[model samples]
Target: MRRLLLASCIALASLSGCASMGGASSSDIAAVLASPSRSADDRQRDARDKPAEVLALAKFKRGDTVADILAGGGYYSEILSGIVGPDGKVLLVNNPGYDAFGKKGYTERLANNRLPNVTHVVGPSDALGIGEGVLDGAVIVMSYHDLYWVDDKMGWPKVDAGRFLDQVVRALKPGGVLLVVDHSAKQGTGSAAAQDLHRIDEQFAIADFRRHGLQWEAAIPVLRNADDDRSKNVFDPAIRGKTDRFVHLYRKP
Candidate 1:
């Protein structure tokens, strides 16, 4: 039965104009946001997160298989599901630590198989359980810093950043897109801020992805907040939702 459903979904997706080149239009995104199935909480967050604008930078097409890596509570997963329609698939991936942290949220979002195209996968940081060259696109939103974080008590162990990235890079097909969005740290701080401030140095992130052989495609400044001094923790009450963030897009060669 499950296989039949997926096959039907793929057939429907193949018929969509979404498979054509270029990103989703503003109208298309707005329509997704306006979905009655979407939660009121997610709609409220759209004002601050600007999800429509961020997703536009990804240039995802219909029938595209995408992964929302370390997706906390499946916020972007739900949105991606709408954008991809019935043809594409959305992988809502979460490491063990993140799964524990966001169990309630994801459980609620995925209840009753509300998102048929989304598959929830929970695995370790080093092995995300996704196959090589299978993904057409992926996104890491605000959670990439977790790669550099280590908290034994919280169940987030020290991750092998290189190996972790290897899994992600290997999962993307040639020409597949990677979109990374994270809170920015001060210049030259590198991953230093990741552990304490929950932020990363923007330049360091670009260079890190480049080292993995993904071509730097574009940097969109839709979420930049200059007033953020890149000092406080992203969870700090003073700047929780107002931190400066960097949005970078990369592609497999």
Candidate 2:
């Protein structure tokens, strides 16, 4: 029954002509962050994450139909639902093998209908299964490196990054935002550090997106940690949640 309920929600979101707002404002974010409904853990991360700033930079507006790609257990989904309001929708896209990382089921976030305006999309990374011209924006947060790092043994199929991003680009409305926040690797290593260190070279990523017709917009250092040496895994005890990260915001134009 839980699976059925989740499927129904995804179907509702997949339908074309869903209403989406144009641009977001500061109040939209402030209200979402300040809402008492947000979990304690969610609020605790504010000092490190600054989600309000992330949302503002991404231009996520009220009534917007956005996809929280690689959204594990709805941390961002819940916040987004509050920001977008009842009229809006947040489609949480999770590729296979996502549960192993968190030791939680794919429906953990969707269970009991905790987020009334949220939907779960389970599929291959390259084919999002979302409709064209339907998304106001899509935010891929802290997990872009997985496109190059996911191994077959992990039950996740190899992602064709070009196709995956192409699909995301197609789903957005004109001038729609596609914001990627990821751990920063060394200056010239490219994707070499993805599997081991769980990071990616910033310049290499920009070039990859440009190849897919995504226009470069802005890069913010909101999550920068100067002490991180870009050597050990992101989960290392020394830098776990404090690794230097780059917020690369782009557009489909």
Candidate 3:
């Protein structure tokens, strides 16, 4: 039944001439952000995250089945729920490590089935349990660096980056969009800074996705902070919410 509904939605999106590059409108983003159900904390973060611009770059549309990968605390998951609407579905995926770190936030966010269209899925990093060719889009916000991060004490295992990306790529239908947003490391640093500064080189991330067969689409610059030198840990108080970030959009072709 769910698959049937999703198929219908996909068909409708096709018939409507949905563009592979951009579809979200300013009003569409405004309506989602204006929702009263959003928590105050998320609203506060908006000033720094500039979610409106980020969502505009994603171009997610009504009835799109999207996934919020490594959805810590369901922040993006909740907002995605509003964008996708009741006809659409949002997969809030998290591995045990992320779940353990964000239990309280996601717990309260999901309590009483607040987000009816969002399905919280807890699974291993290598296999996120999403069916192949099932998603219209997927977003990895501030968590892609975790693929290269390893801390046994923190319960975050060394993720097989290639295998992990393969799962996300396989889940998207041809022409599906993948949006990645993460803190930027110094040029050429690659994934070396992922564990230490919780950052990844923007070029490395683009190349990583391209290697997995995803076409690099756009690099939105709304979140870039010129002041960040990319030297401090992302959690450092001086740059916690003000890090220089990179937003890249890709397509499965």
Candidate 4:
């Protein structure tokens, strides 16, 4: 009995290790991160950046529809529009807080590029109005932290993770993808730094979505730095713009 228990524990440990370390080759990841248009610092920070592969894994077709939650600067949105081709659509969803950076200038920049497939939608942090059961995928890149912040003084209400997931689930077609990438908070911390430093606990994110009927398809620690202590805010001078992050891909049931 003792031997059987020991062997089972060993197997479980090995499986856990495999789960965290799996997915995409280092070379494939390197190519995306090394694109010339991206800054050297950004490239270096995300050594295993593979946004294209993430889209592909979601089965995004040439003409499929996509929603970019928190499409700040339209970086990924632009790339997605090009990939989806002229026939597809890319909704650039931005929260009210993001408008502090100026919408006119942002629109002008994207207009110069003449990306016909992309459209901008502005609204509250928690809700995005696209459509029901039509999107191929919705990618939230480093922006879900805002959901934790609404105007309490104005009775704006707190972020209910359950309601938020239901909204995304309703927006996506059956088996559609929900890809999330954000700065990784420390394990067991349970979203403590999300409000303070704009980072989130990846474990909490996975569990929260799962509770809302989303299945955890896979997780890739493409840009993890196990050394980060999470003691300092993500924007602290020491870790600002270079915090370790986790990239997770989940699917609606």
TM-score of candidate 4 to 2 decimals: 0.74
Estimate, for each residue in 1-253, the C-alpha lDDT of model 3 and write its tens digit. 4564455344434422432335665455655666656678989988899887897787887788999999879888877776666678999899889888889999998898766788989889998898799999999999999999999988887999999999999999999999999999999999999989999999999999999999999987899999999999999999999999999999999
lDDT of 4 by residue, 35-136 (tens): 334444444434345564554445454566888876766666755654455566888877665644436545753664455678887766557577689887
Per-model lDDT: 0.86, 0.76, 0.85, 0.65
What is the TM-score of each predicted model, taking all chains together? 0.92, 0.85, 0.90, 0.74
Candidate 2, residues 1-253: lDDT per residue as tens digits?
Answer: 5664455344333321121344554445655666554557778887688887777788776678899888876677776776666678898877766634543633565667767888887776766687788998888888889888866776766678888888888999998889899999999999889988989999999998889989989987768888988887999998888999999899988
Cα shift from native, residue 145, model 4 (Å): 2.3
In model 1, state the lDDT of residue 137.
96
Ranking by TM-score: 1, 3, 2, 4
All candidates in order of lDDT, best leading: 1, 3, 2, 4
Off by over 4 Å in 2: 1-22, 25-27, 99-108
Measured by lDDT, the strongest candidate is 1
For model 3, which pairs clash?
Answer: none
lDDT of 1 by residue, 1-253 (tens): 5664455345434433543556676555665776656678998989988887888888777778999999989999988887787778999999888898878889998888878889999888888897799999999999998899998988888999999898999999999999999999999999999999999999999999999889999987889999999889999999999999999999999
Pairs that collide in candidate 2 are: none
> In order, what is each prediction's RMSD in angstroms?
4.2, 6.2, 5.9, 13.5
